[model samples]
Target chain A: MEKILPIGEYIEKGINSLEQNLSFLWSAIDDGISWLVENMNDLFLAIPFVIILALIAFIAYYVKAGNKMFTLSGLKKAYGLTIFVILGLLLIYAMGYWEEAIQTTTLVIVSTIIALILGIPFGIWSAKSNTADTVIRPILDFMQTMPAFVYLIPAIFFFSVGNTPGVIATVIFSLPPSVRLTNLGIRNVPGDVIEAGRAFGANENQILYKIQLPLAMPTILAGINQVILLALSMVVIASMVGAKGLGSIVYQGIQQNDIAKGFESGLGIVVLAMILDRITQSIGSKK
Target chain B: MADDNNIRIKVEDLTLIFGKRKKEALELLNQGYSKTDILKKTKCTVGVNKASFEIKKGEIFVIMGLSGSGKSTLIRCLNRLNDPTDGRVYFKEHDITRDSNKQLLDTRRTEMSMVFQKFGLLPHRTILENAAFGLEIRGEPKEQRDEKGMKALKTVGLEGYEDQYPAELSGGMQQRVGLARALANDTDVLLMDEAFSALDPLIKSDMQDELLQIQNKLHKTIVFITHDLDEAMKVGDRIAIMKDGVVEQIGTAEEILTDPATEYVEAFVEKVDRKTIITAETLMFDNPIIVRFKKDGPKAAIRKMREAGVNVLPVEDNDEKFLGYVWLEDMLKLEKEKAKTVESALNTEVPSVYKHYTVEEMLPLITGHHHPLAVVDDEGKLEGIITQTSLIIESTRFDDKEMDKLIGEANEL
Candidate 1:
């Protein structure tokens, strides 16, 4: 092969120079994300097992939109999703992967929150202005379609191999759905309703806050559900960068060639993912 | 024409062009090009062309035309929902066309509110919240706004529907909520852009009646828009008739019907179902000649009928209350029977309609009955008699030229 394209070496040389000069920027981000992930894991560990179980059950009730789970009739009305969450949490405990599962849950939650905080406003900006939409659309396409492993390389280079890099990689992998859906939802609002808001003398901000946001909420929540699922899938890849979670258990089992260890941990991850997915999906379907 | 001070809103040469490049559209309009021609040339629609008219305070001033006549666009311009391309609108001489955004918002919020054709209630909000939307935007406290909303709901007869969403209601009920939303602002003027056109006929008629009843008490200045000519004739105090974005005439319903200013207006009014516009009040002869039942014997009854050059005389009691009617032949029969008073011949079974009833309604009542229809007041006091002769004269009153030639032929005969 002719060495006509030395694009890889050029990119490597450029990244090396950026790493040296932007050392301060990378460290600041590393410190912030590491601190966020650390305290969140510690908080989850400190809570007693039964209390956490009860709390998850309570949230299940709330998101199921006031299903009275205490009574027998209410239990039927509480739906299969809530029952699955309760059983899934117990199964993870029985498998003795409670701590690992919680670590994974913390990782997914933090990445999703950060992704949404950035994504929703960008989405709103995209919906409101043609220039912003034109500029942001291809950037979102790049983030979404690039391989997940490719993100870990840059994330590890910046944050230097920890759960912080994992969080960053997961955030990068999961962000596009949140942004795309929020934009779609807002754009899909009927024009007459928006005109009604304007015709009633509602200022631009009032129309956004009172009419558009409330109407778009269900679709935004659906975006959140997708973000959580994408973050979970990316966390397993993020384990390659020394991130602690159930992903490490599966990685260790694979490296050591232990089928029993791999199957148990993989089953634990499935249960945890199912519980989180159903609850988030249920909340979006409320009303 | 209202007094200067009594005019709630006045538009002066106001024009609205739908597409961009309004200068070209106005130029084309100035050249006397038709609206379609301007649209084809400039890809811009002339929605309203130099529309100048006044809405009297507390009057239901209707702007009416067929679909695509720009009646809806014209009404929207009053509230600046669609800004005009040229000229000015004055809401009490404030020149709203020159208002800043903040000034326009204040004008919309406090002075003039609107009702839309689609019943533009926010789907996410409860009916109460939607009704209180204008008040909420004005920064009123929630409790105060809810109180006003409740009162407005009561005015629209939607009192118990406060907690429901708009989608839960029927279209007519939804439009009433829209009306309540506008009324909750307590504005001096209401801009109704074909507010009842989305509804079916029965509900639309009910809504129109309810609006009139509400106006009877509130007396708010209402600028109504409708494609239906019958609705305009029913509700309008005075009407402005539009065609191809130009207001062809502005006059009372009678003026528009009898003396249309333009040939376009004449053709427009010519299609209107005249029975709906011509009420019994117009057809009735007030204080119609009568024979007193208490005083007139058969002989006197016959004498009164002979003097009046009529075969029938409506008999009234001493209290001026209508008793019945007597025919000259019936009195002659009474004389044959040697009856002294015409009471034996007085027949009280004739159908009587209230004064404002339309001829459309009277047609069914007139069927299978040989006698005249009595026009009465609320007190059953005889206002007039709408005999078959008067009905025939009134029905032919629309085309004066044709009517005059027919009368000329009859006189020649």
Candidate 2:
């Protein structure tokens, strides 16, 4: 009889070796990630609901208005978008999922911000050099296609199952789109425009900041939007590993077979996703 | 060596090769491999090959060639926009090719500015902001940059369009903004790479005239690139014709028209409207037989006319001023009437055209007058003479048959 390969066992053993050897590194990352998530979650929860709504409305208005001056016409131009954000946030509060919604929002914002900060440089590096591109491209592809549940396993092994692991898994899961799109946006800056920049004696840094970055902003924002959406989608999956959010409420309802709670929590996550999506879309659409 | 003070830029043996195997390409190039062969063996594209030239200060030196002839690449090399694979570029005393990044940027900010074929105006920027781009890049203060930008915009006739975005403007307006941007840079040298080629023909001509007007006032040393020979001839004080990454010829419009250096150059010059391009100086015979009134008698003049086999002889005064001409018939009549002096034979009612007058401008004088025209300098000194025969010979020198052959050959180029 043909022998079946024991690939799963080998992976488990290899992971065991890594955990045994890299315990200090793993604990350091775990501690830092925990400290960050706890503080962000606490900060988000501490903010009054009214203030959060005002902040979201302000962001919505700012993006929709385009010009920074808040004239009557500008406010009128932005009112539709602001109203949608207000209604979505108020609905989450009315359903008694305000705290869970805030926790999820905190998770999405924290992971996405960290991921983008890391992703953009990787993107620029990948765009600028062929070696970085060759090395980073397939690694990004692997990170993207690997199951989110699979990220949780190694993440749990390292950080040991909580919001820390949940945030880490979410970050890993959502990072590829940001990196890929930023790379694409920068690479897509017109060759003639880059030549024009160089011809005008702009240095590499100046060209990147003044020419490439401004022109690539829309695409980069689109990438950030993708990262946010991916992060939100991971919240429910993350709750299985003891992360508290609207995802935990949904998970609790599912486990208890309470359809009404499940539906309400599910609706809350959708509302948050819609509001974030529209605001980011508005930002990305600006010239 | 004596023209060193006037030389704004000099490029020596500049060569550029693209691809990963540039070393191999260079080796093959040194061994005399053709560009195609080098490309085949090393996967490299040769951009410019051994291009060398000098642009004098305040002169519009145009580099012209069809696409892929490396004219654009050679111009870029002058500013080190494309770091040449091998060789040096000298902008006045500074060896720009050897300059550090900071020094190069400094030179670009201060001494050189470029206008691009695509207009290269930032879409996100307003027209005024686009015009201010160069000054902004130089870290100039906002108030000063905007003031300078506004002045440049006014120069380009784009005054009211300052706050408008680039997209809101037309193509010609965008190019005007591009010109404004270059002007606002306040550089001594302007490198315009097909700056007007993207515009329609009418707009291109207008821009070309506007550029000449600007040059007349500002006297900025401009290195203009174009595929259109007409544009080159119109604007260039001296034009460098390029082919296959090499400079084929460099000369003024008349010099290129009268004496093309190669078959390719001859073909390029063949298509030029000689009536517009060839001036009276080009068509004039510099050493026409003349009888100086103080030096020669009527007999000597008749003898000279008979020996030279011409019906008309231009009569110059003792000061070599073009007094007029003496017709053979008139001279013979004077001789028969015992007129001792050639002055009696001289017809002072001679048609005169300035040496700088284009043949097209001299056509009316040529058609209305029976006598050959004398080409005189500003002082009315006899520079040369232009007869109808000379005009026809110079204008139709490229016969239809020869032109067909040149057109056939130009197609290959």
Best by DockQ: 2
lDDT for position A116 in model 1: 96
Q: How would you encode candidate 2's per-residue C-alpha lDDT over A223-267 as one tens digit per residue?
A: 999999999999999999988899999999999999999999999
Instruction: Give a tens-digit lDDT track for model 2, residues B1-413.
Output: 77799999998888899899988898898888999998889899998988888899999999999999999989888888888999889999889999888999998888999999998878888999999988888889999999999999999999899999999999999999999999999899999999999999999999999999999999999999999999999999999999988898999988998899999999988889878888887678888889987787777888998998988888888788989888888878887888778876677876898978887888777675678889888888888888776676666676657766766897899
Best by lDDT: 2
TM per prediction: 0.84, 0.90
Scored against the true structure, residue B121 in model 1 reaches a CA lDDT of 80
lDDT of 2 at B2: 77
In order, what lDDT does every prediction score? 0.88, 0.89
True contacts kept of each: 0.57, 0.59
- In model 1, what is chain B's TM-score? 0.76
Looking at candidate 1, what is the lDDT of residue B168? 94
What are the candidates' C-alpha RMSDs? 5.7, 5.0
Residue pairs whose backbone atoms clash in candidate 1? none
Stretches > 4 Å off in candidate 1: A1-21, A65-73, B262-264, B280-387, B393-413
